[model samples]
Target: MSLTRKRKKELKRLRSGAEDLWTQQQEVLANANALAAEARKQAAYYTREEIAPRVRGGYDQYVRPAADTAKATAGRYVGQARERVVTDVIPAVGTAVGTALSVVDHARAARSAAFAGEFKKAGKELTKKTKAATQNSGPGAGSVIAIGLGIIAAVGLLYAVWQTFRADDELWVADEEPAAPASGTTQQ
Candidate 1:
């Protein structure tokens, strides 16, 4: 009544049928072996001379031609290999040399370009330094200007101090005034 029960019943029926088929196959195999033994017994009566010529003829008709064809194909392959070595390989070596030389030429050109760039940079730096040296007259001129300014400032300060000291003595006197009464405070 259920699907599981029906499936189990079908599986049991198939297993029984498989067992019957296996028994039948075993009987058929035994019969075949018995027939093969009888056939071998009958064939044993024939001498080698009867079978040898047929086998040899078959080899000559089929195997010999195939062997000859294989040998010819191998000979052609050897000849082609020799020609390829002579015609293709030798010239390929020259082509490889030319390719290598081109690579070397490229490397040399790159080196030359780099050298030119470096030379240009050095020239620019030299020109800049030369321009700076010519315009400023080197470090000595800067130091000389600095020292001259310092001396001028010192001399002017000294002249001002001397002029103030050499003024009339009355200019240094403080004027006295009468003190005013303070509300618990003195002038600070």
Candidate 2:
């Protein structure tokens, strides 16, 4: 055969295959769309009949009673809890309060004792200072008096010395007038 005729026949075969595939794709898409529509309708019908009633009946028959029971049980629990609190917790709290008060009293007593001890210590210190002061008082007074007397004595001695220096008597006066100068000394 010639090359042009052979090429033409191959091209015709490929075109027919492509057309067949395109028609099959169209058919598949149409079937898919139809199935999706049917599925939506069936879902709507099932929701209305089966799902709706079950949900409504569950709410009415089971869920409501369950909720009411839970509510009643919660109320009873709360009442019992309150009673337990009154019976047990209140006494526990009272005991705790009493214990706290006792501890406070103990602390107060300890503080009082500490304060008394401190007061006693201070009193002891005061007494010691008073005794020391009393013991040293006489010596201190005597020392001051002695110092005053010594100062007076020194002043008296100074006054006597000043008076002697100021007196008219010669400080080296002879008993006789040098024995009349030894009578001119020829009487040796």
Q: Which model scores highest in TM-score?
A: 2
Candidate maximizing lDDT? 2
- What's model 2's lDDT at 110? 52
Query: Relative to the true structure, how large is the alpha-carbon lDDT of every model?
Result: 0.73, 0.75
- TM-scores, all models, native as reference: 0.33, 0.51
Q: Per-residue lDDT for 11-49 in model 2, tens only?
A: 999999999999999999999999999999999999999
Residue pairs with clashing backbones, model 1: none
Clashes of each: 0, 0
List of clashing residue pairs for candidate 2: none
lDDT of 1 by residue, 94-142 (tens): 5545544655655565556557787665555555545644664444433
Model 2 spans with C-alpha error above 4 angstroms: 1-4, 118-188
TM-score of 2: 0.51
